[model samples]
Target: DMTMVLRVIIRNRLSENLRHRFLLNEPVDVILMFGQIMQRNSFTLMCSSLRAHHCPDDVNNPVKEVCPQDTDSRDGFIFARDIPDRSTQSYRVQFRSLILEKKLGDALAIHDKIVSKDKRLIDRSAYNILIWGCGKYGYSRKAYELYTKMKESQLAPSNVTYTSLFNSFANSPYKSESLKLCEKVLRDVKKFDINLNYINYHAMIKAYGRCGDILMAFDLVDEMMSKKIPVNSETISFLLQGCLSQTESGFILAIMIWGKMKQYRIPRIIQHYNLLLRITKSCGVKEAASLHVFLMKNPTFFLPISLLDTESNASENTSKLLPITKKSRDDSAFSNYDSPEKRYNGLGGLDGLLAMMKKDKIKPDIKFFTNILELVPDCDTSENEILNAMSINKVQPDDVFLCMLMKKRCSYNNYEGAKEVLKLFNEYNVKLNVLVYGILATTCRTANDAKMYLESLDSNEIRLNVQILGCMLNNACRSLDYQYIIYLMKQYKIHKITPSKQCLKSLANAHKRGRQIELDIDNNVDVPKKLRQRIKRISYKHFVMSYRPWIKLVRNSEADPWEQFTVKYEDD
Candidate 1:
């Protein structure tokens, strides 16, 4: 019935050609309306069938043929023009895309258009997007530009906005520009009722420190403290770094910051302790010991008394143990507890740390161990004290700390101590990584011990890296060990380690000394294309000046030129 009625309507209404092309079924819109009116229990089925029958074919449909250019103005407006809601969403999408793409100019233009059209729609979310984008792309000017625009549009900046701006300027190449921005932001903090949070102050301090303006960083901290802004871990860390080069002033400032933190009961983070450790290490273990004793006596000034107190009763009885007046606790901690001689005798530097460890019963971590090791060079502590610390705690030194010790020993050419460290690693069952091998190799090279060099290579514990290879090549050339040169080339091939400029230079010199002229040519031939030209230039110079004259003398004698050249080179 459905097909019969539609077919009859189509045949009666138009010419045969038109009937074939024009759809004479109920109009699609009409079918939809009819389905709704009939409550076609199967609405989905009816709609699918209707769509299928009335679907436009490109060859026959007039609507499909009608392009945008052919549409009348009203029809165009109804079908193709953007609605306000759609336009808003599209603008947001495009703005985000531009911001992500780091197309700052495009983003700014779009942002401006959106604001101009509807100022009320701009929110913190939108502002954050722009601020973060600007910082990440290193576009400080655009970031400032956006800030000024946001303010002009009456969108109040939040603390986050200020933080982002501060961070952007802090990381920018123009250090003065960052400082100027920080000053301006700080000045405006109260006017805008913005809380200059720890992050903002930290960024400013770090920026100052990084630019080598330690005094400025100190002044900024003083300004913050004077303003009653709290000192935090970041603030203390920044001050500590600046103090490294200027020991006295830096230590004073660090102690002052620590005092402030303690007064406020801010828990000292690990970094804070590390900084204190470094200061003590620099001053010498004896001084560090005295400082430690002073800190322990004045626990309330450096650490929370609660951390030092083992039992709950100690905390409850804190007032009973000490005079317990707030002002006395603050002022009396750093005051002279005893005469200098008495204090130094009572608490030797490393002994002070040992006493603290015993009192607290807290095992020192790796950083703590390293700090002690660093202080060793400055301490009068005997080797027994050093060995005892390692033996008791079973603390294994990492490659970096071990390497530092190796370098110290090598400076004095103390090969015995260097050998002892390798023995210690073996005794402890510590697996030697590539770095450890490199350090050993370097030490051996510095001592010019070829036997040790070969021994290091024979060790299964260490793998060879580029640095090790370089050290080997350097030693081989300096000692004129031609056989070692052949061994290095074979090892390089087996390990697939590429030689660096220094390594190649040393190898070439070694080859010339060994009179392995053919091997030297082969090595040069295999050099990377870019480096080959440079090596050739250097090799040519050395050959003409050093080898050519020797060659001429040998040839002038009754000796065969090539054989004499080989003999003279080998003898050297």
Candidate 2:
């Protein structure tokens, strides 16, 4: 019946008239006719139908092939099979074709039927199909579910399964669930004895990094090292990229990774240079320079081609029966080259370095200049040295470099010198930001001149921020100006500035002091209750009036005998 139905379907596809007459005439009626044909003598009709319409070509025709001459007689049948079992192979191909066509349900049905008919036919390919199918249909749950079933069915998961599962989870929507799956794999690593190679580790690291879990990525690296798995250039490169997203820790981790690379004899690649360049820029130019010096000292460790080229060439020539003289010439040429400088010069230094780089045929890009600009000046000599280095290297200083120089000058309290730097920024047309004002405000605070500090605040060219307010409040408090305190509170309320605790305390103290002065000036004749209570609450020693002066004056004035005076000491 299966053969007959398959033949009818094929015939319908081959001829439009046949399809219209039998299959498409009336969907329900055609189905009824086919059912009647199948219900009556179905197996015999299937064989006859297949023989007539679906007979194989000569290559696959079993009738044309000769049977084995030697036949072993069983109880009721003769058996002499020369061909190895191809049942699983036929089912596998069919399953793959179904999967390719995106007919997952049909593929699953066929797979189950094949496995039921011949349990021995359930192989790795079969499991892979099911897993891949489940993944394709957005059925990660089903895919994992099938993996458990495969394990229970005593089928071993191939590397392909592991790779697919990892990739599936790499961008999975359910990140928490995906991480759980990753943990499961790690826990069962020993049981499966799955060797997580470089690719596996890289994928896992990338996945964890994408999820913003830098610690997990680092842990994976440690796991690889503990297992004695040799880290390759790509692996280290990937780890470094992940580290770049971290804050300060990225630089420290990058240095550690680079050290590991050197320890493992893994030669530095272009990516390694780029990563180190970025790390140095973020960490500081000094750190970058230190790394560069280390690289220069161990040139052979990093420049593998230069180190092994002579030997490689010699072996090649020897294999061809050539003389060894050519190898020496090659070695001498490579050995005479100067080691590439690793020290990071600031932007100006980079310009000089760029000239040298050009001489060496290395075309530097904008990123190279940016890296130099970001280096924090570590000492007094750093700026000039960086400038000299750039000039010597013939690197052209850009606008960004000028801005960075100005920032450095401002940071070091060299505002007088910063004028020239600021001039450069203007010359380069660099837009000024609020940070420039912050720098100026901070400088004013250091100068400790309230006039200059206030003048800086009045500038319309630069925007004032909370830090400026804080500086003003601090200056006012130190000067103990009651009028300034009142002015600041009014300004704060009008401008919607949030007063800090220090500002609030300073305002309250100023108010208390003002009230005490008012009370002192008023005659000792019964003061207003509100004014008396305010003066009483003035605990600050400087604000509290000495009762001895008031008592002596009161007694001298011949106050009533029933009137009492009380004195209490308050800590400052």
Candidate 3:
């Protein structure tokens, strides 16, 4: 309401002939102060600071304050001028600042205000600035809209604008729409006969890579090489990110892509190496573990000796000092994790990452530990390393880990492991929240075991939630327990709790097997009619929860955590 009122006042008082004109017969100082306040407060320009630009070479530093240059005063516009008229260029700098700071809403509002006040204020430079901001900020649709708007305003989008448009897809979460927008941008570029540059080609390659068209991305890379533009670190990083977006399914492809970097002779950085670890995470635990060993053995891959490896006898007498892992007991043969291309010689997933961190003497931080607790839950070695690293850092176990560890462990029916993790949490004084206590109940493999756990816990300390309720139903999953699954579906009316997709999926699995189970009633029974009804009703309810009158999901905009938690509460 205040913003609307302010806009109305500005429109009424600020004349279209804004050449030193003032309304209300106010003093010059008051008029200037009001103008400053409107621009600063209303448009939010006061809170921005100029930083890096998307295309570093294209940006020019702002000059000192100067008098306003008329948008069209017969002088031809210089797109690459270093000393721009301050009144116009200052705003451009401010807009770029907001963009770099990721204040897209503020930047958009300011751009619209400038356009409304004087369309002439929006020259090709300003349009490019706005387009670039929208593209960088995951607003691909908005970026596309602004691109069309530029054409309608008789302002042709230059190569920079096209590059920004391509970037709109590169970072976009909406891959399909971004690809469509990219196609439109390509058509416009061809239609305009605008010559392409290295930067433009790179941006298009990244866009295609991120949008899951790695073949297209590869073609562009080939084109860049054909045109004598060397494949650089940035290009390799973009391809790595593309592989990451596809998850473990792209592991072989990633190896082939890594060969390209090797082919071009680009040295691997911490970022690229880190990306490799994340991509390898999906390639079975055994393969990933071997990769870790390979990376640690290689001196060329940044050899700061591990804190453990410091002992002279650590390598030679390692078997005597260390306990055997499951991998060693089962299959002792050495193997390589590679695709058709043997270029990516040794790339491990989470296990390799831990080894790399140990070698670098980089004590893994709490954020890294917490993120991987989800990513590589079954890695016992990683868990032990995380604890040791925390001990070295002297950081306490986070309260979240208490609850979260239970959820992940219980999902796998690792009851003993869940109990051990909770004990570790207790040693560090982690609070026993409802999430922890409830999920702990489900950790027990059998309903009788779960009932015993529930019986043993103190009533005052254990409060039940959807997660707890899910646990109570012991919604026995991933194994042959079905009592909790059927029981949970029936109890929704008596208990107010959100339905989880994990539980829903478990129910689907049970339906597939048509397995009958022993209910607490001491007789075997099949879950048929009630299960079907609840599935239909809850499925519709969950849909309503994910979709609504408001634009995006509440998981993002409205801080609706309950819905978010239940949506992705469990991995399986």
Give lDDT per model, in order. 0.53, 0.51, 0.54
Residue pairs in collision within model 1: none
Better of 1 and 2 by TM-score: 1
What's model 2's TM-score?
A: 0.33
lDDT tens digits by residue: candidate 1, 1-572: 45456446546654465345435443443333233233334433443444445553523433222233422222011111211221232234445676676565566654664556434355565776777666665455556777877787677888778767766665565656666765676677767777676677776677566444665676677667767888776777876765554443344334445445544555555665566567554422223234444546754442333322232322321222222233333323423322323222223445665554554455655576666565555222444476578668776666666665665565456767767777666776766677666766755542336456656567765556778877766776665544455456556667766666687677567556445444465766454453344335544345435544433332354332113111111100
Clashes (N, CA, C under 3 Å) per candidate: 0, 9, 0
Error of 3 at 327 (Å): 28
When 2 and 3 are scored with TM-score, the better candidate is 3
Q: Give me the runs in candidate 2 sitting further than 4 Å from their true place.
A: 1-123, 126-146, 212-216, 244-248, 273-572
- Mind giving the per-residue lDDT tens digits that candidate 3 earns over 519-546? 3113524455554344345433442343
Ranking by lDDT: 3, 1, 2
RMSD of each: 19.8, 24.1, 14.6
At residue 177, what lDDT does model 2 achieve? 72
Off by over 4 Å in 3: 1-34, 37-121, 158-160, 190-202, 245-249, 282-382, 385-408, 419-572
